[model samples]
Target chain A: MTTAKRDTYTPETLLTVAVQVFIERGYDGTSMEHLSKAAGISKSSIYHHVTGKEELLRRAVSRALDELFGILDEEHARVGSAAERLEYVVRRMVEVLMAELPYVTLLLRVRGNTGTERWALERRREFDHRVADLLRAAAAEGDVRSDVEVRLATRLVFGMINSIVEWYRPDGLDGRGGSGGAGEREVVDAVARLVFGGLRKAS
Target chain B: MTTAKRDTYTPETLLTVAVQVFIERGYDGTSMEHLSKAAGISKSSIYHHVTGKEELLRRAVSRALDELFGILDEEHARVGSAAERLEYVVRRMVEVLMAELPYVTLLLRVRGNTGTERWALERRREFDHRVADLLRAAAAEGDVRSDVEVRLATRLVFGMINSIVEWYRPDGLDGRGGSGGAGEREVVDAVARLVFGGLRKAS
Candidate 1:
């Protein structure tokens, strides 16, 4: 049986601790003891906060998935010309990734080791598909370059954007700056300009 | 006691198996039994091939490192205008990445869990720094855009190129007709052209 206390824990707070542990020890290597230590709460206290380890993983991935899928529902993403919408989604992706760095980082690294991880992988694929559609639409409109296949372009764009988790340091001192007037927005802007405008000099 | 045999397994063959397992189970989760089973050889037989798992990892990463560092020593990468040399390096990078997809993929996925992985990570950073110097030189020459920081441009370019491994399936079923044409080269060429040139159409 699980013990419950009113003032102790919320799912969100527990998830914060869990995501950090998951990133540090890796999802596969992390166990309940590690979680208890990281959370500063007893193992049973963690159970009180969430169902089990997998539940915490599910909740964290779900939060990231929800945020990413939410981008598609926005008016700018939903109703604009494909090129405009693609640009908007790209910017929003960079913002979302930065805002939810740790969670999304976990989501990106899931290797389908558990039921929860498999679910995260599926949701991630669904999100990629939705974004790929936008790229396809843009290609059809000829607003973006059609020289590259829509699938390849989508993956490459994602690669450029998603690689942020590999080196992006929110605190700015991990050797990649965040305070040089080049915060998340600047990154989003640079990605958008480069992807859409290409890198050539304007005549 | 580990057995020594007169007839030996080569490091290259051992590296091939190690890289595959590393990709499947990830670097941290795999063990010697897993490798032995995959190799269809005895545990001692594996020792005949290499020193241990770390040696296998070191050898694999070294192959990737050699290929990448070799690019810098090439004539095209050494002498011409910075912009031209940068272009040659970029194009050659795509070609080399395709040619050495597996080794580079493993090198990129390492998380610095062990001494070999840490060394690989350091080497990767050194390679990135070397490429960044080329981009910096190009910017200094006024050949590339000065609006974006040299570090940022270097990362974005690396992001685009490194992304190829995620989607590329050297032996995937669709290989017969998919992206196997001039279409792939065109995309690489376009990426180079765009990086050197901005997206704006000239008057």
Candidate 2:
């Protein structure tokens, strides 16, 4: 690589390349050699930006975790009826996930193999519990269904929301070949509808 | 280790061990050495059961795909109204997923890096399309909400169902300290209720 190109490679840019490699190759399967090759820089150049691959992994997941935890502290999430707050958080989760697709995708795929991964998993459980508590409150106020257990309901709802990373491609056109706007709004609405109202048309 | 234990290893038994390792270490990360170590058999004995790691992957995914495809042929999935059939298939999917949790978990995580992985992915998409067609049919019959696009709705619902593999532990107790029977039934019922009626209590 040229000196100018090497000089231009910042930690943020290196992290972008590393996250792609980590996602494509499982994090455990990825190596410093792979990141250096993908970045078109020498291994030393990579080391200069971050300590190692674990540092990159840490930065990437921390970014995702920060965005997710940020949702819980928002005013809507704090002040509304439990059900309404849950809805706002759900919609924002979709938006945040789409906005930070690659980072959140990496976060969702971690399997707790390393220290960073275990920390990410614990934070994820904490996030899920916060959302579950909202659902529990909603159930108590008779806003959501009492028929299902709150924790079970929370998991299923989250399962619906988090599963978006599996298929959503922001750059791609919608199913009908429309632009991203309609497709994106439809996802948020569909999730809210399906989560609260369900697939069956109301009687 | 022992001749008696070595003699007892059948292809089915070997596969059971292989799938567990594949889930823990990931298919790409695992090797024949990992498999032999986990199975307590020699590497040659593993090769005796299957040609190589790829064969184990192919066999493991094939079993999962076969079970999922089998759901489409069952009477309830075939003979009901579009909405009813979709509901039946959804319920059956949760049951099949929980029943064959480990195999299907491995199946859901495939990233299409290998030929076998790509084949598994293709089969998965095919199965998804088959179910998507059911959702489309339900929408056409005016049995489901018409506002959300059919294909989009299908993806979101599939996302919910598939995400179960991430968290549901069959041997684990329920939130309220209940046993697996009630917990298991609750999952199926919760999914069906959430998928159809959603979380909102009816007015």
lDDT of model 1 at position B57: 85
Error of 1 at A9 (Å): 2.3
Q: lDDT of candidate 1 vs native?
A: 0.78
lDDT of 2: 0.86
Give the best candidate by DockQ: 2
Model 1: CAPRI class = acceptable
How does chain B of model 1 score on TM-score? Answer: 0.87
Instruction: Please report how far candidate 2 places residue A9 from its true position, in Å.
Output: 2.2
Q: Could you tell me every candidate's TM-score relative to the true structure?
A: 0.87, 0.91
Per-residue lDDT tens digits for candidate 2, residues B1-203, read: 35524546888878888889999888878989898878877888777778999898888889999999999999999997899999999999999898998889999888778999999988998998899899889988989888777777788888888888877778765553322234567888889999999989988
Score candidate 2 by DockQ: 0.66
